[model samples]
Target: MHAIVLYTSKYGSTKDYAGWIAEEIGCEVRETKKTCIEDLAPYDTIILGGGLYAEVIAGASLLVKNAAALKGKKVAIFSTGITPLSYREYYDTLVLEKNFKDGIPEGFKVFNFMGKMILDELSLPHRTAIKALKKLMSGKKNPTEMEKLLIELCDADGDFTDKDAIKPLLDYIRN
Candidate 1:
């Protein structure tokens, strides 16, 4: 299939998944910033992984913006986040809508995986933003289910990357 894994990780979780996917698929792995659309022209199957922050995915614009140029290619986008896959409604609805405002491209599929959010390893700015978001959400007298999840996620501190999570994506690519 000539697939390649490209990732944009803020704290390594996305990169970890990309490495695992590449190893299993026996394809090349690279960071999105270090690559360009033209470099991917030869690859028919493209796997793009990125960390999720503030409801937005890091470095996914490259794939989304170049969807036109990728005509006929099979594109898979995986988002790594702390919100847990159990919250399918959030990923299937909220995240999908936010990231694909124009509509998902043809032959494109999206996947969500558990990601790390070690409190101590976070950067100063990211930590501060999390704290502020936590405070803001905590103040809501009647927060929605999504808001409550975000508040809880802000305090999450552990590695949630699972190698098994790559199976479905790999299977899809193989088929």
Candidate 2:
């Protein structure tokens, strides 16, 4: 099947994942800025990835807004983030709700993968936001589970990407 991997990465994790997926699946990889919905017409399978900023998947509006045009095409969307997978509520519930307000499309599937968060590499605004978030959460004497997780995540500072994490996505595409 014809396929293409398109991605929008704030740092480099999402681009790295897109590269790996393209390498394994033998498909072209392009940045979303250089691609448009019309550019995707030739591919039967489209894999779009973006790094998570707040709860939104960066550049995902392209797919969400153009869902009608992608009908009948196999679509897989992935988000790279530092949040641990054990937080099912965060990924499955909060993330899904915020990203897909109209509900996931019929042929679309979503995946989440661990990404790097080196404090030194973060943008100035991102670093400031993290510091603010950490301070806010830490101030809560009776912080909720999510708030606690947020505080913990603020200090996370390393690459957490794993090649094995793409296996499930590859399986989906192959099938």
- Per model, state how many residue pairs clash: 0, 0
C-alpha-based local distance difference test score of model 2: 0.93
For model 2 the TM-score comes to 0.97
Alpha carbon deviation, residue 86, candidate 2 (Å): 1.3
Clashing pairs for model 2 are none
**Where does candidate 2 stray beyond 4 Å?**
none
- Candidate 2 residues 1-175, lDDT tens each? 9999999998899999999999999999999989989999999999999988888998888998899999999999999999998888999999999999999998899999999999998899999999999999999999998999999999999999998999999999999
Q: Give lDDT tens digits, candidate 1, residues 1-175.
A: 8999999998999999999999999999999999999999999999999999876878888999889999899999999999988888888788888888899999899989999999999999999999999999999999998899989989899999999989999999999
Model 1 alpha-carbon drift over 4 Å, by segment: none
* lDDT at residue 119 of model 2 (Cα atoms): 98
Model 1: colliding residue pairs = none
Error of 1 at 158 (Å): 0.4
* TM-score, every prediction: 0.97, 0.97
